[model samples]
Target chain A: MERTGAAAIIIGNEVLTAKVKDENGPHLIQRLRELGIPLRSVETILDDVDAIVDAVARARRRARYVFTSGGIGPTHDDVTVRAVALALGRSVVRLPEMVSALHARAGDTPVTAEGLRLADAPEGAVLLAQPGMWFPVLTVDDIYLLPGVPQLFRLQLETVLARLSGTPVHLVSLFFTLGESALAAVLDRVALDMPHVAIGSYPVFDASLDYRVKVTVEAQERSQVDEAVGRLLGALPTDSLVRRE
Target chain B: MERTGAAAIIIGNEVLTAKVKDENGPHLIQRLRELGIPLRSVETILDDVDAIVDAVARARRRARYVFTSGGIGPTHDDVTVRAVALALGRSVVRLPEMVSALHARAGDTPVTAEGLRLADAPEGAVLLAQPGMWFPVLTVDDIYLLPGVPQLFRLQLETVLARLSGTPVHLVSLFFTLGESALAAVLDRVALDMPHVAIGSYPVFDASLDYRVKVTVEAQERSQVDEAVGRLLGALPTDSLVRRE
Candidate 1:
């Protein structure tokens, strides 16, 4: 299948172990949505080479773009670069540009051997100049290896997203007084008939809310979304629909 | 490999589309940590059957318990039950217990066919009686099928968690004034020496914080954690060490 959307892999042991609540995954999801780039999945895994390799390879197979958060530091746990290289069947190589950049940043101070780990990347890697940051974005093919630091992740993400293009989906939501069980058939029929249109049914449990369920119809074109919504509204009882947006 | 921990699959189109920030994944991670169960991974995928099946099968292979959130309702989008059944190579069957419970809940009113869809589950599924709720926790093998609604998910999760057991990890944190580049070598040595202990190095960019990096040492035994911490503290520069916790 042709890859279209983006996929994210959050290599965060701190997040999986609950030491830190993951800000990157949610932030990436929100930013990707705002950019109108459809996201296929967001996987949170440990900072292990095998797991990272598997996740990266799987993401590449399904998504046009793969964004990885965390595991991009000098520490031993920072194995995303190596794992990603293995996933792409490439050897890890020290990028001369990154080495030069590190030396420039260090100035007169001698860069430690461990510090030079920051310069290592997949054999064929490109660096995108980042504004206001010493380290540039590390990218190979369509995969972007981002630092786990929330601040750094945000800044680098902005730089990467600026270069990509997306088509924003047209969406309409219908609020219903009836529950999913009451509205399932009509939704099933409309969703089945308009396979291109993406339909979502979300049940709301809050008694304070006026609606019981919220049905969303979305597609690349406004006409498809509108047509699907119209079909759903027509098939369902008029009294059931509280409002449509 | 012996499956000892838990893995989660958050089947959420709304989450992937950024219509809703996923509360369930974070909540599950926190709860699992509190319960002393190590979490292997948490994958958030769109509410699609192929995606759900792939994720479920993968989780089962790596974890003793697999928890899936969302796509458990009556609508066309609610395909978790069918998908999970396919993942396990089982046929979907309506549970008599759930059907009876639904009938009892409906009382004088006739239950819709869509409403009875809630009774469907993978063959040989068991329902754990959920206290203070009409629905019980649905389980086939070690997979727990949970609702996407935050409130319902929380309540059901508690019921399921209470039935399982876990061993809390022994953990210690060390604060350093030095960055990861300065600490990588020492950490690498300690981590390589003791494979049992999980060592994590997190760099704090906030200048307001007293420490530049926070290192976590953890294992099943307190002595192991303490030993790892001691090795780390001994190897790093005395002036770089800020504190320990």
Candidate 2:
């Protein structure tokens, strides 16, 4: 399928209420950008089956790829599998291989009766195989179910995402320490002069000069980005600099 | 005005593409919740003046207090002041007191540039009074313009948020370690039993555990919260606990 953009559904109460800062969206966005894909939006929701199902449905309809982080766990709140199944209208059942793999991983934890349910997945769903690993690989359709854990999400996506590649996006960032009020006229002038190079300004609080402006140049060709940044930076105030990423 | 809910808008390209992790939203949400305000949503937008204006306008209509973080630096991308002017249809100009204050703060150095126009603010807007600060303090209606720099946003809010003493919110959390599938039936029982408490499930990922479940109960009374947690915890799969936080 021709890919357009990807979105993320972060399902966890800890994240929504500022209990934990989410890192998956940022991590995925960087990877997607490198692959030349655009990240559309991120929706953070509480750990409710209906909410997850609703968010997934909306994300899939809006984006070419929808990655769900969190909720694919082996606990009371790990409702991703069931919710995904319900969202897809599939029956839930235990896969033999997953059960065996989980049992092997647990050793003597009564995997069959207690932890054996980890093997359960929506009927007809392909198990991703996670024995002594983070997440079981599974692809139902456009959705990729990943562990809510940041490390597990990163590890699993590194392997699964290799199958899906995206086109490169030309982007540039312009950092500025110039007070925003004082730079409006220059920004307006630069933006009016160059609309294609995508001149973006970001405020860096880390700079001692009060603000740092990073002007990024992105284009199909590196030269076009360079030329655009050159022109845009020249039109801006004394503090603008063009940099390549 | 009496507090109802809180929300934040992060405006910047760095966050949009994952170039920088946004810290303002979570910081605000955490502090707001501790003061008993529920967070409705956190939105991230590009560095377009019109976009920022539109978002702030919308937030004013939805939330009791809306905070805009970013674009208040000494750079050309700092369009926050102008955007606030547009949002409220107010003419912006350099306030005399503000320029002198900033000049005093900047002292001698590259910081002085014909006042740097850091004082441009929407006409008749309430100055947040971070005097000597580059970001303008503008309170147009209910929306508050803030610096995207995490620490600055935190400090600036402290200066203005005291006027909005929030009502108290009673809440409790219960964590379950048993895999989600193992606790569905019992969770259903808890939901049926706890009718007054606002129950929400939070699925968390632990590096060592399968998945951790946090069940949050919010109510008017502490006893209600405590009872909800007790019942909710008891209803979970046996032997699944990580302690309430």
Candidate 3:
């Protein structure tokens, strides 16, 4: 089975400057994993138009779905929409519906020229609308434009995920007190035996925690993952295995 | 003055799967900022050789320096060295000095075949040796290969930073109770007036916190940043300004 490929572009200078830690990349990673789309790559780039355009174009070529977070706000730094449009050779135009929505939402407050920029997107882009959402999500070609705010990004992602479907991967994880080196040989053997399964070994070195390595087995077939996990468990020393509920 | 550009490649499947939250990207970002190099891009790619090569080559073209974290370990997944070599059109070769170091460090512990893989690097790569460090940091061309462990990556980065230099950027930030929309016009005006300084406005929506917006000003000179900050402070509504030490 061919796995669907996905890539994410996290656009913000705050994230790159380390002033604001990114909550979007990790959130999107988990969501893509749960959706069974193999997130091939994630680029956290500065709020530069050239960089944004290059990242989006590269991601578009590499993956079936591309998600971008940040730079959609009404500010000097917000340029993702225009960048995406330029990258895809499309022109950015203001949507009348979004302008009217902003007008309706702004009642007592006056909408500035910058505020109206939020209504603009790549030509032919689709706006995703849902009840109670203050703003609609924008989709241009295969790229999904999402807000930088963690709360809004998560909410919009859920709505986006509902419209997309993918094959779910079966995964099994086993924790071991033994170091990664101790399990390397057995993992290599198991991996060679099961070419279809993807095996990963992650070491967690915490003085407070007893677990040293977390070995994960993933495959399209549940039986393949289970078989690899069973073999891995049998190969490891019983004393090193960490049993958890 | 032109700013020196830097980019990072975070190589691992664990990170892409969300099984591991990346500590490397944030750590590197902070370090690069302190070192005064303008980090342009950060790519978190899987442990695939092609992906690693593509990311490294792209970063190398865009930035003066490229730092890659992870995939240098002694395992099936550790392919950073080879991938980087391929990307740079070089061949991977085992370094006798590294092998000797590994042997010396192993003492009573037997060095497995996988463990010996740590001795390999790109043909033209230079290993950075320092006092008190168990293993030397690898540098092929401009790409610095760092370990995934936060502690190790930080240590290696400090050593790496000592050899490099960049013009420092001065920054000043102010918090305000006023929302982003309320301050947008003033910020636009300030940005227009101070072309050399970069102004950014970030909104924080927390019911518990009084501060709604955090405006940051950055420039090559401290005076320029301070000038922009002064103008911004004077332009905002006095009642909405949040005083901070």
Candidate 4:
């Protein structure tokens, strides 16, 4: 693995049980893609420490970067901070910097007796500090810890993503009406020929548009992506109906 | 492995890419549970045939009964049926019985060349037939393929789920405030004591409320589930509050 991108490990029971709509996975996926990093897998599991530790260990081994959302809050189910420590075979201890950051944050709101605990991080973690923001991220061993709240998940990711960004998104999206079965051979050819550009297919249905297919090609440069996608579309049934719009 | 119940596989690029909110997984999870089947796992993937085939194959092997949602529509991205056939090493062809059924259902609606192709399925597959309101389910090796559209997905499921009935959901959830660090030993002991009941933990955060933990236990009977949950909660930290209306 030459370190091209990241994968997400979403640890939360609320998502699996349907109590909360999982926003972390998608939000991170989109942002990571825009930053030119492919999100490999989004695994949602219970808030169990062993499971979290196992997931973290797996992610650390595979992805160039690994980000986790949820379970890092001040409340009881919030065991991500501890679980991460256990995963790294380290002790959970307070980071003085994050504690001061929280004190400055706990200004207007009545920070609960246990709220201060949120500031603590696993020992030797790098703090992606946000004094005003509700959620804070602590990065250790390539894993960035984030809050599950959609708002916090987004804010922290923005601040953190800026620091570890790779390539910028560049590609052309072609939406047309076609069946994949009839075009599988052509797709296989394109995939074989264009190794640099990534092609993804998405099928969508709407009342007005009974059936539509969106083929997106992402690459390091716009010309490379566009040229590869152009070649693939040329082998299709009809190029006229295949609108680049 | 004797099939305990049916499993649901979520197929879509939108879901894997996190572009769209996935309703299929939760919907099928509830429907299958009501039908007395325990859902094994919900796997989301990009609109790639190989990926779809691999996931479908895995699901089919793990659970005697497998239901796939998404990837069976009228667009280029709709490759679920083809993928299933490929995974089974079968060929995709139009089923006359299904074609007639679809023709009758699309009575007033204009049937495009692509629309008629919706009747295609793997050879020798039984039709999980829906009188007129839903897409037909094609079964290959005990795997039932369903549509991705929520409305049609629900209609198609009703016909198949009705075949397997009388499985009541004996699961109760208790949300409380307690950190895992303080009660890891108690949870470990409970896991050993209760061999039958399923235990899971979820962490949730709300704007107005402090983050908390929700623990769920699933069993064959309500009493079994309740007793197990009670015993587990008792071992947790005292003075912790649980979720209430």
Candidate 5:
């Protein structure tokens, strides 16, 4: 119930319209899991300002950290910065550091007024310099503004995750030969009894699969997970369980 | 500005926890696009009751049709019916048709009390008999509660989409050698002038790609899209133009 995990908001119209597939959401899910951080949610919405604001505000209320992908570029659809600022009730201010960086990068060519829009960010924003890249990860009040591009998103995500810590959850999986209908009662009992341990029941419809239902019991403490798995094993039909890991 | 698009709520802890990759969201997006229906958003949230309620409420306010995936089963985690009911300000009730179908399918073996939970639905629910399947598609209002299983989700989606109508959007993709920052001014001008047409600019970071940015111009009318594309081509530098489709 405590808001400890991270939440993601992927801002892209191309993905919703089927012009492009979203690779950032899945990648973020995998990375967050690998880092032992539990993810609260992933919302893929259009590149609209109000939608981004709503998503970011909701995500902030339910999570300690919020990460938004895309809509940070210097174009018409790039409204993430403005939206995130609105959500945080902050003014969009041009970062002098970013302006200097852009000027330095441009060198001989003058940075256009539109191109200088990249220097803008929510007030009190912090920039985490990314190695081997010019654009730093723009962040404010635990909300990370990540690029929509897959490669950049992955890189910026690593930069953000390095600063956070989480407890790794210990899990035990039990696969059964019987279906969910036969296993629901027992699972309900264990799940209800062990509030600390998270129990998940998934049924496989494919006949080719060896197991019919996959039950997962997980907890921050290994002992709790093991105890719940033991109780499940004891209550379930011995012959019905195909394997446990 | 009107609520005309479809929105999706993917209720699954497995997806958020990285236990399983979500295939249903992408499949739904692709199918909705093929059906010429605009997708408002796709939110992947936990199986928590309050989470489902909040997402459903927000989705209903934004889109005409809402599709929810997962959490429809005979287990404790299967709380979609209860959550959706609360969202719609309705009560959960047992569907007599579902009860009869369960009885016919079970035959000689009696169904468990927990198994009978599958017969429960939100008030004023309708069951669309799925072709070649024993179970039917559970729907209420414009919300379709689909199974989590990939195959079942795909099949049920087709059945739901068949009943809906949409106008196919006319799209024109233009690839350019110039980056977003270089083309932002022209794009902003055309995008502001042609409010009916939607224009998107995306930058490519990879050097392997031939183009620096891919610009998308789309509208329900082909003439609007073509006019926007022509305006963009005319405004942009002739040498910087790559190709258009």
Candidate 6:
């Protein structure tokens, strides 16, 4: 079966302003890759309604699954749910199950109006229940609304990953001491020859690092990735090959 | 002076696949903020031509300046320049000055066709030369094409930043032990009252962290930020205020 394409939308003003370093995008990228979902793009947008709506709509059109991080809390800045609802032409309604979960989590503390807002989701959205989860994961159509908090986002993503499967990509990396310019021609030739595989060359400038050029060969098929890596290694000058791992 | 909006397109397959952690986005975000240019969005896209072209077109339409990092090298995956040129209805051309610089850097080594390809830039693109720079930074219209290498990208960005300036934003942060839900109502009231100041509340869940809710007040004017912070402190419960910084 063909692997499904995925895209992510990271919504927050703090992230766009450099006030907060985004941990969600990196985390999702790693996790989604592990789950075999090929993430096509990640867009870090502001907390504005129009931006969120536009990003979500575009991401939905581009990929099979859209994961959104942040802007789902009770705070005024949290507008992901409203934006997604507006974008999909759906109304935001309070989910009774989520309200009960929020009340239970509060224990003796009264659930304030702001806290109850956490229960709101797009109309006809599904609540994903998981073991030991305080709040149920909310999904509207193909978009998954995840908490901005890194821990919560990871927890909810793991549950989502459990239900989804795709063709696992195989990657083979070859490191070289030569600069990318020196290997560019060979890489281009190999890329042209093997259109089935994705070949990438990255120049690492860190003096402390061992390699200068890190070439990666990737494909859904392990044999194709391995063959491409072999060809890349053979094409490189023997002296320039640092290590193949 | 009004702060100009900026957007970034991070073009690379390595970043999207989690094979490489992106250093450019955060680096640019902080640098752009310090330069008083507010970054509106950052889209990490694949090395595909259509993706790069589409992202660049969208970013150009959205912001005053559009910055693209990566896909400027000589390798096959380096398609950013071509994409930008096609998107803007221009053609790519080899830059003689860049070729000379590359030859100089190579010293005794012969400049290969691949190495010379680095000299290619979008039609009518200006090469911004800076002191002690080996390569001139490429700029087409308001779009800056930067390298993927972290050190080189930083160097190029510094040169670009020196030529640009805008109204710097002032930020005041207040920490509280109370959850965001507890402060939501007060935050909404403060946000409504202070239209100029951008108020944001972030919930930090780490037990090791001293504060739960981090409220940020930002504005172009320092006085407005200060005033909003004062009003926010006054509205919050005394016991909930963990620390104000």
Instruction: List, residue by residue over B43-152, the lDDT tens digit for candidate 4.
Output: 56566687678767766765678888777765555688899899999999888886786678668865656666678888768876577655567777778887776767
Interface RMSD of each: 0.7, 4.9, 2.3, 6.3, 0.6, 1.7
Please give, for residues B56-134, the per-residue lDDT of candidate 2 as tens digits: 6755665687778887655556678888789778888777777776777767744445346666677886776664455
Candidate 6 chain B weakest lDDT stretch, 10 residues: B1-10
Per-residue accuracy of model 5 over A1-245 as CA lDDT, tens digit each: 57788999999899999989999999999888888899999999999999999999999999999999999999999999999999999999999999999999999998999999999999999999998789999999999999999999989999999999988889788999988888999999999999999999999998898999999999999999988988989998799989888
- The most accurate candidate by DockQ is 1
Q: For candidate 5, lDDT tens digit of each residue in B23-91?
A: 999999999998789999999999999999999999999999999999999999999999999999999
What's the lDDT for residue A118 in model 1?
97
Real contacts retained, model 1:
0.92
- DockQ, candidate no. 4: 0.18
Per-residue lDDT tens digits of candidate 1, residues A1-245? 57999999999999999999999999999988888899999999999999999999999999999999999999999999999999999999999988999899899988899999999999999999999898999999999999999999999999999999888888898999998898998888988888999999999998999999999999999999888988888888899888888
Off by over 4 Å in 2: A1-3, A47-62, A71-141, A168-187, A203-212, A233-245, B1-3, B48-62, B72-126, B131-136, B167-177, B195-220, B233-245
- Model 1 chain B worst lDDT run, 10 consecutive residues: B228-237
Superior by lDDT: candidate 2 or candidate 6: 6
lDDT of model 3 at position A54: 91
Model 4 alpha-carbon drift over 4 Å, by segment: A1-3, A47-62, A71-127, A133-136, A149-152, A175-207, A210-218, A228-244, B1-8, B33-36, B48-64, B70-127, B130-135, B147-152, B170-220, B224-245
TM-score of each: 0.99, 0.72, 0.90, 0.68, 0.99, 0.93
What overall lDDT goes with each candidate model? 0.94, 0.67, 0.86, 0.69, 0.93, 0.88
Question: Model 3, range B50-80, lDDT digits (tens) per residue?
Answer: 8999999888888889999998877777889
- Model 1 CAPRI rating: high
lDDT of 2 by residue, A109-218 (tens): 65535356567787787755544573477657767887776877887777667778775666666565554444556655666666665555554456455345455556
Question: What is the CA-based DockQ of model 2?
Answer: 0.28
- Model 2 gets an lDDT of 0.67
Docking class of 5: high
In model 2, the Cα lDDT at residue A233 comes to 60
lDDT of 4 by residue, A1-245 (tens): 34536767677555554555677777777777666676655666667687688767756765778888888765445679998998889888887776676677666655544566777778878876665664457888788998776777788888888788677767677776764444445655686778777666555555487446666777788898878877876787675245674
- State which candidate, 2 or 3, has the greater lDDT: 3
Point out the higher-scoring one by TM-score: 2 or 3: 3
Candidate 1 wrongly placed segments (more than 4 Å): none
